[model samples]
Target: MPTPNPAALEFLLTRRSRPWRTLCLPAPDRDALHPLLTAAARTPDHGKLEPWRFIVLERPALDAMAQMVADRGGVTGVEPEKLSKSQAEYATSPLAVVVVAAPKPSEKIPQMEQHYSAGAVCLALLNAALAAGWGANWLSGWPSRDPEITAWLGLSETESIAGIIHIGTESAIPPDRPRPDLGKLTTWFTP
Candidate 1:
């Protein structure tokens, strides 16, 4: 008989993403990170096109990304406050993964479907990190959507970042945020 996984389901139903700003030291290492990536890859793929990829942001990579943001601020007229926040997004990140939605050129595989797959991978990665007992949050600031920033991240025109997931141990557990009413949103058809 297949083993029932009630606990996993329960976790999914109530899982809440920790804020990136609340994360601190002791992020996942290579051995620890491999399994989480494997879990994320198990997300549903309509045609198995694997229309996404991950870029692990360790210390060195994080510094490089932060510098790029600074360079961008100079050219794009970003104000100091916003620029500081952009810098914090990378500077304070002990561990992060950039989820890129790389749409393949195929008439059969609609671009929307590829987009959906990419989004699924993002959630899967977030959930996997939480399940592994880590604090993780998905973030994408102006930089993520900026064309200039995309070029810096080495993404082709057809590629987009689903999210940038910041992960680490929790420095503080914030209060639970309110959720939308499921009953109000759902419709039952009992014909």
Candidate 2:
């Protein structure tokens, strides 16, 4: 029989992302965040090729980034609503972690696998934050994908943002959203 961790399983089953807009102040400090990052770093890494990194964005940086997005919005022709949403995400966020998918060169491992590892890191970080009683949400928008913004983030030519995870205190508990239908989404295969 397989030994199971009931608490962990329960947490996984019930985990829900707190909306970014609903997140407030009292964000985790560097010391507090150290463990969360450590937990994230423990994500499965094939071949020990660590293909990701974290970039913590505190309030000041987020505010500046928000302004940068606004400044570039008009010139870049970003739609008004989209621009506003993106700006608000940064401006109001207490803290954020940018999971940069920096894939290291590997002879056996494929580049796509490295990208997947980065994505896994993002989820692990998000979950770690939530498990630590902090409200967390994984987000990405036009700003994340914009070359200029990515450049501002100091990403290299090959690096990309797997996710931008917002972490802070929750103003209010968000209602649980509908989950996907497991029967429809899953497939049972047999030879």
Whose TM-score is greatest here? 2
Q: How far off is model 1, as Cα RMSD?
A: 1.8
Which pairs in model 2 have colliding backbones?
A: none
- Name the lDDT value of residue 75 in candidate 2: 81
- The residue ranges of model 1 lying beyond 4 angstroms of the native Cα positions read 1-4, 189-191
Q: lDDT (0-100) at residue 175 of candidate 1? A: 85
lDDT (CA) per prediction? 0.91, 0.94
TM-score between model 2 and native: 0.98
After superposition, the stretches of candidate 2 with alpha carbons farther than 4 Å from their true spots are none
| Model 1: residue 26 alpha-carbon error in angstroms | 0.8
lDDT of 2 by residue, 1-191 (tens): 99999999999999999999999999999999999999999988998999999899999999999998998887899999999998999999999999999999989989999999999999999999999999999998888888988999899999999999999999999899889999998989998
State in Å the error of residue 120, model 1: 0.6
TM-scores for the candidates: 0.93, 0.98
> Model 1, range 15-119, lDDT digits (tens) per residue?
989987898889999999999999999999988899999989999999998988888987898999999899888988889999999988888989999999999
